[model samples]
Target chain A: MSRVLMKGNEAMALAAIKGGCDAFFGYPITPQNEIPEYLSEHMAKEDRVFVQAESEVAAINMVYGAGGAGARVLTSSSSPGIALKQEGISYLAGSEVPCVIINVMRGGPGLGGIQPSQADYNQITRGGGNGDYHLLSYAPENLQEAVDLIKQSFDKADAYRNPVMIAVDGLLGQMMEPVDLERTPDSKQRERKEWATDGDAGRRGKANTIVSLHLDPNKLEEHNLALKEKYDRMVENEQRYERLETEDAELVFIAYGSTARIARSAVESLREEGYKVGMIRPITLWPFPENAFKKLPDTVHTLLTLEMSLGQMHQDVKIVNQGRYHLDLYARTGGVVPEPEEFIEKAKAILKKEDAA
Target chain B: MNSDTVYRPKQGLTDREFHYCPGCTHGIIHKLVGEVLTEQGLIGEAIGVASVGCSVLNYVYFDCDMQQAAHGRAPAVATGIKRVRENHAVFTYQGDGDLASIGLAEAVHAAHRGENITVIFVNNAIYGMTGGQMAPTTLIGQKTTTSPFGREKEGTGEPLRVSELLATVPGAAYLERVSVHDPKHVRKAKKALEKAFDTQMKGKGFSLVEFISTCPVNWGIQPRESLDWAVENMIPYYPLGVFKDPEKEEEDD
Candidate 1:
C-alpha cells in the first residue's frame, strides 16, 4: 500500500482498476467526469476497456453487458446522468449482474446544479429504477472513504450478485484527502468464472441462459419473491452504521454522506460547548442502520435529521425513532450544503429546548 | 409414424411455449437465431440483448446469456458487453418502434462509433406490444391504434428506412435488409446473421441486419395473410437487399 492524496472521483477510478475492473463505461457529467476522464487515459494502458458512450443510457447498458460477461465493470454519473441510467440499472438488478455504479450526487429533480448535495437519497436508497429491487448503497463522507468503499463495492456486488452503488456527494467527489492505495486481491486468487458468461468451455455441459424475463406471471412472481428473500438476507447481513458519542446523549444527529460529515463537526463543537449531543451516521443507506437508532437509550430525547434534500431521509429516521423520540428536520437543497457552524447552532438550540422541557 | 419419428420442431426452445400469436414471424426468427447459435458453437460465447417490444421474453427462448434492454437501448448494452469481454459475441434483437423511435440515439451512435457488435433489427411496421400503435416505420396510409386515420406522410413523416440510412454512416461496416416472408428470404437473413457474426469475429466494426418481419396479430389480418401483406405492402416501401458488404467492398478496393 502507498499513501497518496487524491480526489474522491480519481480515487474511485483507481480503485475500480485495482479491483480488476475490465471495463469503464460512462458519459460526461458534472463532479464525476473526472472518473471517466481518468479511466479513458489509464484503462487501455491496463489492458482494460474504456468507452465514452453517447449517453448515460448507453454507458450503463455497456456496464450491463460487461457485467453479464462476468467482468468487474463500472459506470459513474451525477444526478441527471444517473437518471438516464435508471432503466439500465434496473435491468442489471433484475438480471442479477454484479457491477459497481458510482453516483456523485448533485441537486436534482431536474438539472439541479453541479454542487455537493445528498438530494438523491430517495432515488439511491429506494429503487431508482422500475421494479422491485434494492441497490447496496454505500455513502462515503470523505475522499478516503470513497476509495475504500469503491474497492469494497465490487466485492459486495459479486457477493450479493447484485449492483452496488457508491453514493457520494459532489463534495466528496471534488475534495482531496490522504489515502493509502491498496492493491486488490488478484482475480486469479478469487473464485474463477463460476457464475459468469465466460464461454462455458470446461465447467458446464451447455450454455447457461442469463435473463430476467419469465413471461409466465407465476414464474415472474416467484423470481421476484426470491429477489425479496435475497434483499432480506442483505438487510440482515450488511447493515452498517457509526455512533459518535451516542452513549449518554440527550440529542442525536442523524445524517449520512456529506451531511454526516457536517454533523460530525457539529457533534465535536457541541461537545466542546458542553452539550450532550451525539451523531449516528449511516454508511449503508439501503440496509440502513435502523437497529443502531433503535439501540439508543430512552434518555435520548430528540433526534435531528439533517440532509441536503428536504425531508427525504427524515422519514426513515422517524420510522426508526418509532415515535419514541421527537423528530426535527433540517435540510438545504438546490446545491447548498449545510455549514458545520449552522448545524452546531441548531444542535445547541435543540438541547436548550430539551432542558427547558 | 411414432411421435418421436415425426418431424418435430427444434428442441432449443423452452417447453413453456411462447406468448407470440399463431403465424407470428417472431417465433420463426427466434428459431433461426437459436439454430445459428447452436450450429456455430457460439452458444456459450454468445450474449443476446433483448429489446423492448413483443420480443422482450426472447431471453426465455435463446439458450445463452440474455439481457433485456429498455426500448432501443440494446445496441448500447451490447457495445458495453462486447467492449469488456471482447472474446464474447454480443448481439441485440430489436423491433421497429424500439429501434427507430425512442432508442434512435443509441442505435445511431453505436453504428457511428463502429462498435464491434451485431444488431438484428426486426421491422414489423407497427408496434405489437402496445396494441398496434403507429411506429416510426409504419407505412404510408397504414391504419393502427395511434394512427387510426392512417399514417399521413405530411403529418407523421415518411417511414424510416434504417438500413439505407445506416449504410451511409461511415462507421457501419456491413448493412443488409432481408425479409423473412419466404424460405429463400429466411435463408438469406440467416446468411446475413452469419456474416454479421463473422465481421465481429474479424474485428470489423458495426454490422446490422434489418429483417422485414410480419406482425400478423397486430395487423388485424389472418396469420397466413399477413405474409402476403408484408410482401405486397411492406416490401416495396422498405426494399430488400444488402446495402453494404465490407468484405466485398474491400475486395473491389
Candidate 2:
C-alpha cells in the first residue's frame, strides 16, 4: 500500500478503481470534476469503462444500466447536478440496482456556489429520487475516511442490492490528504448476481428481468414493504459513527462530514479550558446512528448540532435526541464554513441561553 | 407438449400477454423481434431494454433478460448493458414519444458511438399511454388532447422523420424504416429485425429499424382503419426504405 497525498475526489476515484469498480460514468461538475478527470485518465489506461456522459441525467441512466447488468459502476456530481440525477436515482432504487454514487456537495437550493456545503444532507440521505426508497448514505469527515467509505460502499451496494451515496462537502474533495491506494478489499469481490441481466447463457430458459413498474396498487405496496424490510436490516447491521469524550461530559456536539472534523478542533479547545465537552460524529447519516445517541452518558445535558447547511441534519439530531437533552443548531450555509472559534462561540451562546432560561 | 416442436411460439417471447392497447402494432413488432432473435440463435443471450410509454413492461414480454429504463433513457441504458456484457445482444424497444422527444440525445449519441445494439423504435404518431397527446413525431394538423385545436405548423413543428435523422450519424451501420400493416409488410418487418440483430452479431455497429406503427384507440380509428391510416398517412409522411445499410453498400462495392 503506497501512501500518497491525494485530493479527496482523486482519492475517491482511485478507491473505486482499487475496489474493482467496472465502470465510471459521469458528467463534469464543479468540486467533483477531479473525480471524472482522474477516472478518465486512469480508467482508459487500465482499459476499464470510463464515459463522460452527455449530461448528469444520461450519466445516471448509464449507471442504472451498468448496475442492472451486474457490473460495479460509479457516478459523481455536485449538488445541482445531483438534483438532475434524482429521477434516474429513483429508477435505480425502484429497480433495486446496485451501484455507487458520489455527491461532493456544493451549496444549493438551486444554482448555488461551487464550494463546500452540507446543504445536500436531506437530498442524499432521504433518497432524492421519487418513491419510497433510501440510499445507503455515508458522510465521511475526512479524506481518509472518505476513501475507506467509498471503497466499502460498492460492497454495501452489492450486498444490499441498492444504491449507496457518499455525500461529502466540497472542501473534503479539494483538500489534499495522505491515502493508501492499495486498501482495496479482496474479500468483498461479489459473486454472480442472479437477479442481474448478465445474459442467460447456460443459466435457464427464463431471462433475468429487472423492472420497477408495479402497475397494480397491491403489488406496488408489496414492493415498497420488501424495500422497507431491506432498509430495516441496514438499520440493524450497518449503522456506524464515532463518539469522543462523552464520559462525564455535560455538553455534547453532534456533527458529521466536514463539520464534524471542524468540531473536533473546537471540542479540544473547550476541553483544554476545563469544560466537559464531547462529540458524536455520525458516519452513516441515513441510519442516523440513533443507538449512539441512546448510548450517551448521563453527564450530557445539552446536544448541539453543527452543520454547513441551514440546519438540515439538525432535524435528524432532534429525532434521535428525543427531547432528553436540549437540542440546538449552529449552522452556516451557501458555501460558508464555520471556523473552530466560531463554533466555540455558538456553543457557548447556546449553553448560556439555556442557563438564562 | 410437443415432442418435436414445429409450431410452438418462439422461445424468445414469453407467454405473458402484451399490455399494448387494442389494435396497437407494438405486439407485431415484439413478435418480429422474438422471431428475429430466435432465427439468429440469440434468444437466450439477448438483453432487451424497455423504454417508458406504452411498452414499459416489455421487460415481462421478452423471454430474454430485460431492463425497464426511465422515459427516453433506453438508449443510455442499452449502452450500459451492452458495455458491461459485450457478448450479449442488447436492444431497446421504444415508442415514438420516448425516442424522438426526451430521449433524442441518447439515441443520437449511442448511434454516434457505434454501440453494438439494436433499436426497434415504433413510431405510432401519438402518445398512447397517457392518452392521445402530441408526440414529437405527431403529424402537423393532428389533433390530440394537448393539441385540441389541431397541431399547427407554427406551433409544434413538423412530424419528426427519425430514421432519416439517425441515418446521418457516422457510426450507425444499418438503419431502416418499415411498416407492419399487412401480412406482406409484417413479413418484411421481421426480415428487417433479423438484419438488425445480424448487424450487431457481426459487431458491425449501431442498428435501428423504425416501424411505421398504428395506434387505433388513440387515433380515433378502428383497427382496420388504423392499418389503412398507416399506409395512407404515416407511410407517405415517414416513408419506408433502407436509409443506410453499410453491409448492403459493402456488398454493392
Candidate 3:
C-alpha cells in the first residue's frame, strides 16, 4: 500500500470505514471535527450510517443504539465533549455493547483551552463513567499508528464485547503525516453477535433485549464479576509497549502518545551526550504495560515519567513500580507541549538530584 | 386447551407480568402498542426502546427486539437504531419526566432531524416511578411530593404540552394528544398509536402519540377516580387533539 499524506483525524475516519464500521455518530468538537466531517460524506458514499448528533451525550447513546442493533459503530469527541459522553459510556459498558470512541485530547478541568494536553489520562484509563468498568484504551503517537489502532479497535471492541477508546492529543489530531490506510486484519477473530437486538425477522425464538439494569443484588454482583473476568483477560493478553534501548541503560523514560515522540527525541540526544538513557512507550494505557517495567535491566535504577498534564499517568506508574525503581515526574499542564530539550534538562536535573541523594 | 379459545392474549407481549402499579395506565398503553405491532405484523420487525421512568422495564414485556435507554435519552437511542436498521420499525416508550424534563433535547432534536421513528409519550401529570414527584407535565394546581404546596405556575411554570411543542417542529410528520380515561377514549388512544406506527411504516418522518394517562397511586386517588381526575383536571389543561399531520394536510390540499 502506498503511503498518503493525511490529517490525523481524517485518517482515523477513513480507517473506521476500512475497519468495517457500519455507522458513525458524532458531534463536532475542536481538533476532532474533521473525523465527523469526513465520515459524513464518505459514509454516505459507502452506503453506511452517519449521524451528526445534537450533543456528545446523544452521540454516545446513539452509539449504544447502533451497536446494540448489531452495527459496527464509532463516535469521536474532545475533552469536555468526552466528559459529556460519560453517562452513555457507562450505559454502554453496563450493557456490554461493542463500539469505538476516539477522544482527541485537549486541555480541560471544564471548558479549558483547545490546545493539546494529556489531562484526560485519568478520565480515559480510570472509570470516568460510574461503574466498575474499563475501556480497552490505546494512545498512539503518530498518524500511521493511530490509523492502524483505530482500524483494529473495531474488531477488538467486538471481540471483547466492550467499548475501545483511542486517546490522541490535540496536536496529533491537527497534525499532518503520511499514513498507509490499507486494511490490516488483526488475529483476533470476531464472532457474530447473537445478542444484538436487530429485530427478529422471524429467525429468533425470543426477543433480544439490550439492557444494563439488574434489579436483583445477587444478579448485579454476578454481572459485575463477569465484567471483571473480561477485564482480567484484557490485562493478561493485551499489554503492548515499545522498548527503546533499555538494555544496559542507567535511566528509562516513560511516555505515550505525542509526548512519547518528544521523549524519543530526548532519549536519542541524551545517548549521544553519553547519558545512557532509554525509553518505554506505552501503547495501551488501560493495561498500563506493567510488563515493560519487568524488562528493565538491573543497571536501570531511575524511571522518569513525562506527560502534558499534572502527573495523572504518574499514578499508574507508581502503582506498577512498587518502589522497584526511583520514580520522577515532569509535567507541563494547561495545554503546554514541552520541547525535547526541556525533557533533556528535566532528565539531567532529575539524575543530578538522584546522584546527590 | 386449543379449540374453544375465543379471546387470546396479545402475542406481541411476553408472558412476563408487568411491574407497574395496579390501575397504572402504563399496562393499558403497553397493550395498545402490543396490539398495534401485532396487528401490523411488525412484532418480528420492530425494536422498542424503553425509557428510564415507569416504562423502564417495558423491555421485558415488549416481545420484540428491545433496548433500555438512560434517563431522557430514548429518542437518541431510537435514532441510532433506526439509522442502523432503516427497514425495521423502531420506537421509544417515554414518560413526561423522561421526555419533557430531562430528555427534552434528545426528543426535540430527534423530531427536528425528522428521524423515521415512533415515540409513545405518556403524560400522567406526575412522576409515578419516583413516588409521585412533580413532573414537567404536572397540573398547575396539582400537589405532589416535590410540589407539596400545590404546583405554583410562578416558580415551576405551567405543565408542558409535549404534543403541541413537537407539532411546531417541521420534521414531525404526525403528532397527536390522546387520553385513555374511558373505554371510548382507550379505543381512540389505540387508534392514535396505530396511526403513529403507520407514519413510521410509511417512511413519513418523526411521529409521536402523547397519551394522557392515569397514575392512581401517585395522584392519591382511587383507580377509577384517577381516570375521572385525569378527564376533569388534566384534559382541561392538556386538551386532546391532533396537533400535526403532514399526510392529512396533503390530503386536505
RMSD in angstroms, all models? 3.1, 2.5, 2.1
DockQ, all models = 0.55, 0.71, 0.83
Candidate 3 at B57: error in angstroms?
Answer: 0.7
User: Largest DockQ belongs to which candidate?
Assistant: 3
Global fold similarity of model 3 (TM-score): 0.97
Docking class of 1: medium
**A156 in model 2: Cα distance from truth in Å?**
0.8
True contacts kept of each: 0.67, 0.72, 0.86
Candidate 2 lDDT, tens digit per residue, B52-103? 9988888888888899999999999998988888988999999999999999
Candidate 1 residue lDDT tens string, A294-340: 77876789999999999999989877777888899889998998899
For candidate 3, chain B by itself scores a TM value of 0.95
Model 2 chain B: lowest-lDDT 10 consecutive positions: B1-10
For all predictions in the order shown, the interface RMSD in Å is 2.4, 1.2, 1.0
Tell me which of candidates 1 and 2 scores higher on lDDT: 2
Runs in model 3 lying further than 4 Å from the true structure: A186-191, B1-8
lDDT of 2: 0.88
Q: Which residue pairs in candidate 3 collide?
A: none
Going through the candidates in order, what is chain B's TM-score?
0.94, 0.95, 0.95
After superposition, candidate 2 runs with Cα above 4 Å error = A183-187, A352-357, B1-8, B248-253
Model 1, position A61: C-alpha lDDT score? 84
